[model samples]
Target: MKLTYYPGCSLEGTASDYAAGIAGVAGLLGLTLAELPDWNCCGASAAHSLDAEAARALPIRNLRLAQRIGLDVVAPCALCFNRLKAGAKDLEAKGERLSFRVWDLLDLLTQPVFLKRMAARLVTPLTGLQAVCYYGCLVNRPPKITDAPTPENPGNMEKLLQTLGATPLEWSFKTDCCGAGLAVARPDLIDRLVRRLYDRARRAGAECIVVSCQMCQANLDLPQARISRQAGQKYELPVLYFTELIALALGHPEVPRWLARHLVDPRPVLAAKGLLEIPAPQASG
Candidate 1:
């Protein structure tokens, strides 16, 4: 499977580890993600608040570019996927013609086809791992825009993890807002939300919180120290990108590189589960 790939700003910057995992796992899944040429920003957490048209323009231009390549576009960032989906709807309203589709990388990969290859490619299944799949606000909210039938309790990530031999713990905060976009404007709110989410995950019996959003990963991972300091309790829960876990399960050589990019290291937990050792390289089929 081949599609146009849009690595939004966060993917290249804060979410570089996510990008590494994406790159490593694509080959294993027999999927090709061609970067959209001359692609630009997709008006992430900021644009729509100020001007609707201006926000739509950024992703619309990207859609047009994907249309040029005549392939479906895959955006790894939740915000980018949301923006692109909204932009496509805007174009549809204007009676504009386009010849491609936009998909969230998470939604795209969980399809049956990719799911089939995952089982075969499992060099090391995360059998003993237990985590809460954290899907932040933008991924499946506003059901009409995202076309998510089960937006309330989407099991895409859970299903994927089960396929990889990992147990996904259930938690009510699966689609809750992380308040990451408001970190600068209202850090107090971010702290409160992060703390609640962390407390909930811990209470749910999860060893970690696995996420698909850059902002969620950053907000959840980067603030644990401060949260612990303020609350006078240690919250060492690690936040890991779902892709990183996949890459590790697939025994990607770059797995260490990807894990190293995390603010709160996940190696200790992975070590405790005996999942830290890199499997020896295997020849291609």
Candidate 2:
């Protein structure tokens, strides 16, 4: 099960932890990942807004790179997955048939082969952790592009969580927008959106929020304090990446490093569940 991996810009930059977790989990699952050579940005949330042609071209270029390697592409980032799927659709519309497939990591995990491997590798089952799987806006929108069965009510993450011994809570706002890419420009709106998500997750008795998008993680994790302050409430929820949880279940050595990168500390939550040990600070001169 070798695939051309596209880490994309976000995975290389702000979401490097995601990249690590994916790589680690893939290794554990015996899935070989060959990175696309010299790949460029997929022109995420901004590309289509400015120029449709450029947006399509950027991802198509990467798809061609994957084709050269003669393998399907696996993009872990939701925005990257959407852009690549859109690019393939654009080419198909123009009568250009591509030789390979583009798969979101979530889609790949749903396969029986991967699920079997993942179950065998789970040393520490995440028992008693109630979570709401947040799909954000782009992962499964426009049905045709993403090929998601129920875009409004996705269950991929929930299914994956169940296999790892975690409880995926039922809740609304699963597919609602988390103010994607508008964090800086219209934070007021973002705050409101985050608040709604938090309120719902809490109402559903979820201890944390699990997401597949880096943008959603940032909006939900980083702005918690301010959003809480603005709403005259407190939200101490731990927002985690699906990959990170997989790494924890697989007992990956770097799980601590991945957990350390979160804006909202997840150690407390993990510690409470007896799932992690907070490493002691290093002695310094």
Candidate 3:
């Protein structure tokens, strides 16, 4: 029920809500998230692009700490997860000499015992939700990070969706790009990517788009209005972090907390469907 939780830099700052949401839901799910004693950035895109050794080394430090404590690490950030996963895969593949040891957070979280425990704790009814799970291009690509189901067609998220009682909509955009960092530099390109995903999700009859990558969520969720305007089509799918949907399925009352900082509000869609529940405040410990 417990694993070393690496919140990464984003989770500690602007994405604090994601960290809280994970903590809150983990409590309800009877899961224990133990934070690493000292953790640093996994050097996601920046590190990998600048220096491969440093990029691998950053995640190795955290993983080494986890291995030392005899507990596997669980990274909530997609970029961090990808970095750590890539490092572990490289080490495993080439038997590379390591100044430190490392392991994939997915390795621990997806273990049968942990997954079963998580499924057992998911009691909130999800009879009404039809979600299109998006894994984006980071964690699943380059073949080094995610190990199973291939990048072109992924099912890990769908498996988790089924376990939580929601129907996973079949869609081609699950593993497609959301135009990522290009959102700032080349919004026109990002607009095309977003429109493609939005159109596909709508065609597949998804109630909302579920994502694990924060950057992907930021790109797709925030700019829906602008993208729609540019494409000259009405698109209004509620984009959410997978953790947020999991929290809702766990019967947490504070659903709105997850969307407070979102550029587009999804409360109306949930409200229109009569699934919006005022999330009750949790007593601070």
Q: Any residue pairs clashing in model 3, and if so which?
A: 253-279, 254-279
In candidate 1, stretches whose alpha carbon ends up further than 4 angstroms from where it belongs are 278-285
The global Cα lDDT (0 to 1) of model 1 is 0.87
lDDT of 1 by residue, 95-153 (tens): 98778888988999889988888888898899899999999988898988898889989
Please provide, for model 2 over 1-285, each residue's C-alpha lDDT reduced to its tens digit, 9 standing for 90 to 100. Answer: 899888888888888877888888888888899889999999987899899889989999998888788798988888899999999999899998889889988888768887788898789999999999999878799889998889988898999999999999999889999886888888888888889999999999999999987888888999999987888878899999888898888888888777778877787788789887665233110
> Per-residue lDDT for 44-149 in model 3, tens only?
7778888989998897777777666765566776678788778777666788544433323333444566567667776565666888998887666766466545
The C-alpha stretches of model 3 lying farther than 4 A from their native spots are: 90-123, 278-285
lDDT for each of the candidates? 0.87, 0.87, 0.72
Candidates' RMSD to native: 3.8, 2.1, 3.8
User: Can you give the TM-score per candidate against the true fold?
Assistant: 0.95, 0.95, 0.84
